[model samples]
Target: MTSQIAAGLLICLCATAWRMMRSLPAWLRLATGAVLLAGLTAAVVQMVGSPLQPVFVATGAAAVVWEQVVVAAWWLLAARLLVEVLRSTLFNRGLAAKGRLQGDLLAGLIYLAAVLTVVDTVLDLPIRALLATSGVIAIVLGLALQSTLADVFSGIAVGIERPFNIGDRVWLEGPIEGVVDQVNWRSVRIRTDGGDIATVPHSVAAKSRVINRSVPTPQRSDSVRIPCAASVPPERVAELVRHALLLSPRILAQPQPAVALVRIGRRSNEYEIGFAVASSNDLWHAKSTLLEQVLRQFRSAGVETADRPGGGATSEPDPASGSRRFLAIPLFHDIADDQRERLCRQALSRSLEPGDALFRQGDTEGSLFFVASGVMEVTRTVGARSSSLGRIGAGDYIGEIGLLTGAPHAATITALTPSDVLELRKEHLAPLLAETPHLMHAFEASARRGQALFDRRVAASVGAETVPPGQLLARIRDYFRVHHVRPGPDAHAARRHPAAQANSPPGGD
Candidate 1:
């Protein structure tokens, strides 16, 4: 009896030590536990077979109580070892949130089986009667804890299905939208964008609609409804909204944002600007930025909003008002009003539908194009891989370098919408350059700025000295067939270029 008690104490001590050395490698800990359990079993076998067995009580059943205690302890140690092995081998490392719950449930079953075995095998009880009695008790407990059991089963189902994992951004039917923080047997914890933690139960989550935004890709599609005066053309409003979407860095360009008139009212039209962001979290910032950009674009183009206090929409700019268009251009801002009108008269208006190429890369046409209204994309192709350099919208100009330096178009310009472009050929500009001799310096400065920007955009290396101002001025004069080009007093000031300055608010870098 004393030997049996010693064996039980040895088993308990081994279990405590195994649990204490948790930082050890799992396999090594498991091996140590198996060795201890085997040693205890051997010690008990030897004690029961040897003549030196000790008796604690006179009654036969009580005399074997110590053996039963040792047997039960052995069974428990074996169950614990099996549980540890299963936990290390079959659960959690890849299972993520579902692993621990599954491990616990498995361990419970193993321990229950060990306890039943101890009752029937060690103490020699009637297994059939015991199971029959346990069946009724199980039914009673299951009914009493119906909701809890439902949660448990639902958690298992969730684990098996894996609709969303930890760290995924999800939307539940409870209107609960957030990043999954922690998932357990009872509930899933979500960290919301508003910095609040939401606990949603597995049963509720299973029954509700679950949206996993993190799967496949984190990109999220969103849109905003913009109210514009119905007086403005739908095509015009769509172009402006599309330009604003292209301007936003947070908004993705691959999907190509869309703008469409969804609703028309008595005095206003509602346009839906649909776009995508890199992640669900970026949706708000992208939307707000796009809205700001849209407002700026509308203001710049004199397009009125439906909510404008007077309820009267501003009329669109006259396409034939060349001088007014020239005044809006920063390039012609230095030209006097009368000279600008003459310059505008010499320019030719060219209209384009969407997908029309104004000029392609490597085209050496010595002409400048000014966007009267609409958006154009600038793309540069290098070794079969074409990348977008930027987008140009209303009031932006292109082909300055091609015109001034007689260089081929460094990038292709394609009309993104129904666009009105004004073309000024070198031949038409020479007489004006000869009359307004100082315009050569403005053109030189603008060309230099354009060349620098083009070089930066294409990632071309700039020499320590590119074209000198004298050489660039000579090239412009030679290209335009103009003689005796005079430098203005502000020519040196023009040399200190705002290289980073954007041509238009919607123009891309």
Candidate 2:
């Protein structure tokens, strides 16, 4: 009779467990159902109603022990299933929700509660007593680990407040600047422009004053200070600086650019050229192109910059005290003064009349041209269609990509107006490359930058009318006016003008 009752109880348990399994999630159902089946099998084996001798009862008792083991296994499996379900649900909801920081914290708390619930229910423990004890322990731990606790709480606060998000350029209290990589429970990870990763404790990050460059709008006004020789009129310097920034592709157009004479020093006058940029990531590149343009413009205009006492002579002057110091483009500023001088020397001046073709698309690459006086249009012909790539103006370089790759010119270069250009041949670059492998990296980097700009312009023009060859010339002219600069004269005239020659150092004497 007892054996029959045991078998009936096993059947009932198996049915109930199967129902539970069907009601559960797919992953949980498989794990929990397997455990329940093992338990039912053990219970059935232990049934004493089977017609057997005393030895059979002893064997049945051993099977009862196995049933207990199965029950314990079922509890473990149930706990595991609960944890996984809670984790998955919390993670999915947290990530999908809009306020990332708030969602993450809430999700973590939910996970913690779910874990505790699983422990209490599956293990059949008295949770209230454990909770009371944990509260007391937590208070003691909080006092002892003040800083760590602060960090954890601060991390939570960061999620809730969200001063910055991933990919934001932030300046923290320590004056450290970087793009926020992630926000975690204890710390925030930032990857600096130098490619170094910094882990800042959430406590510090939360309390510290942070400048979120990516917030509200990613655009920010940036300034570069260049010292001009006192000989150059301050008004002309300002105009020149403003014009240089306008020609740069990196400068934002909506805000417009401004230049001011910040201070006058013994050897030079310091000027600040201010402009807005679309992003902090573009800051370095924009500044580099700006400086290059400024130097080229100043040189073409017969303006002399302050020189370093030894051989590292620069074209800009030092500003007086109390003047706002401008930021220099980091990488380009690292080039030795001698290399820049060699580059200037190796460059050959040329002038192109309007309608002149500098090179066709299939022409062999020879030298890269840097615009020194006027505007040129770059066009690519693919199949029967011809598309305008972009316009090159004073200080912009062309043909570097093909020169480096030893490929035919990808685009046809034509003079949009009477233009001036400084040509740097591959042979002249060999000595520079041999002396500094770093220059090669710079050239390659510049080429990649040019390609990126080309890609962006091409993408923006997609679906628009294919800009006619004449329309391209008109567009180039419009771009110049919008930037507040006009092409002055042909390259040959600019080079031979009395003003340019007057600024030349006395060599015949």
Candidate 3:
């Protein structure tokens, strides 16, 4: 009765553990099995402590059969536990392939040995004949599963060599560019950029050339070709393009982007902009951002590309060009057409080479600047600490607070690329505000919004509280010396341009 209870408990534990195979870690399950095995051994010892009676000889045979059955179960459980430990070790050492192909093969051999030992010793079977028949069956199965066995063996090789681990971004000869999601016995699974899972058979993958982009380094290098008219000097084109490449925040600057006149044609010259990004995932965004900056840079420098209808730089600046540029600004959008033209005409255009500083952090210059083209970086210094606030691009304006309320520039503005800034002094804007006193309120609100955005981008915890809304309006009135006029509910709404939102600094909100 004692042995029977022990065997029943052991069976129950095994069943419970097997059911929870996926839920429980292999080491935990192995520990549970080991405890049960120890308990079973104790129970067996207790059963053996008592001697059998002579009158119960017939019953003794039945008892022996029951003991054999229990011992056989113990051997099978031990074999499984051993396999679990080995599998765990293999995974820890990175020796196990995805899906445990090598571990599974080893487990099969261990299980086969356990079964053979049980048949020979526990069940008392004819071992020699069984072995001979099993050899023949193994041969037949091997022949039938030739391709499957090839994959299994190839997977084992992959486990040992470890060409690329799961989650590594790899490129195959099939022009397959994607991340490695899984490596099962039969195939390697790749998740493409388009979110499709592609399965390549292990046999085929073994033969194909693979490039592991994730290994060594994750940075990927790419280039864009811009064609300019043969009339434009390559040196000028190269300098403009190099500055444009540097303007993009996505493109890495450490390796230093390269610009070269790679191809020359009778009608046009093609320059290649070579740059590297943090990863292949950033390639598209970096390329697009660089191209946009290049277009802005070329336009600002009066350079023309081959694709443009005129094939050469504008010989003379248009009279209305300044007005057109100013009209695009949201603050000047609502002003009368005549007012905009006069203001733009009076505005002074300042050209800055790369790394030029428009103003330093503590500059008290009470002036507004509009980004005509190219990109500029905004940085602020508070005491001993200096940090980048963000970047401002074309169609964006800066120095609003300084221009409106005579507030000192809170941040330093510097040219990241070849930039053209249109500087507007108080005298230039005075007439417009004089005619429309309500424009004071619009200017105040825009400045407030920009300051709030700058504060948040710096960090919420360290951000300083902005000036009160009414106080800012009052300050603007005092600075401009204009009488207060009630602004309409939607006075600022009609002045907003859709493109301004996208082209604004990082803190567009």
Best by TM-score: 3
TM-score order of candidates, top first:
3, 1, 2
Model 1, C-alpha of 286: deviation from truth (Å): 5.2
Instruction: Spell out the clash pairs found in candidate 3.
Output: none
1-509 in candidate 3: lDDT tens per residue?
76667776877778677677757877677788788777766655555431211111215687877766666676787787788788678665764534456656778899998888878766778999898999999899999999988887777777777889877899999989999888877888999999999998888788889899988899999899988777777887876777677567789986788998889987678988888999999999999888987887676555667745545554223435644664565455455555665666778888998799988776767777777766777777778988886676654566666667676666777787777778887777776677567667666655555556632243211112334446877878898898867666444553553222232222101
**By the lDDT metric, which is better: model 2 or model 3?**
3
| lDDT per residue as tens, model 2, 59-119 | 5665655443334433344444454454457644554332345555555565576456545
Kindly report which residue stretches of model 2 are placed more than 4 angstroms away from their true locations once superposed.
Answer: 1-90, 96-130, 217-220, 264-267, 306-372, 381-509
Off by over 4 Å in 1: 1-73, 92-99, 119-163, 173-175, 194-197, 201-222, 233-263, 273-282, 285-302, 307-317, 320-348, 353-356, 362-369, 389-391, 395-410, 423-509
Model 2 alpha-carbon miss at residue 232, Å: 2.9
User: Please, what's the RMSD in Å of model 1?
Assistant: 8.3
lDDT tens readout by residue for model 1, 242-296 = 7777667689987878887899898888989888899987898888878977886
User: Comparing 1 and 2 by lDDT, which wins?
Assistant: 1
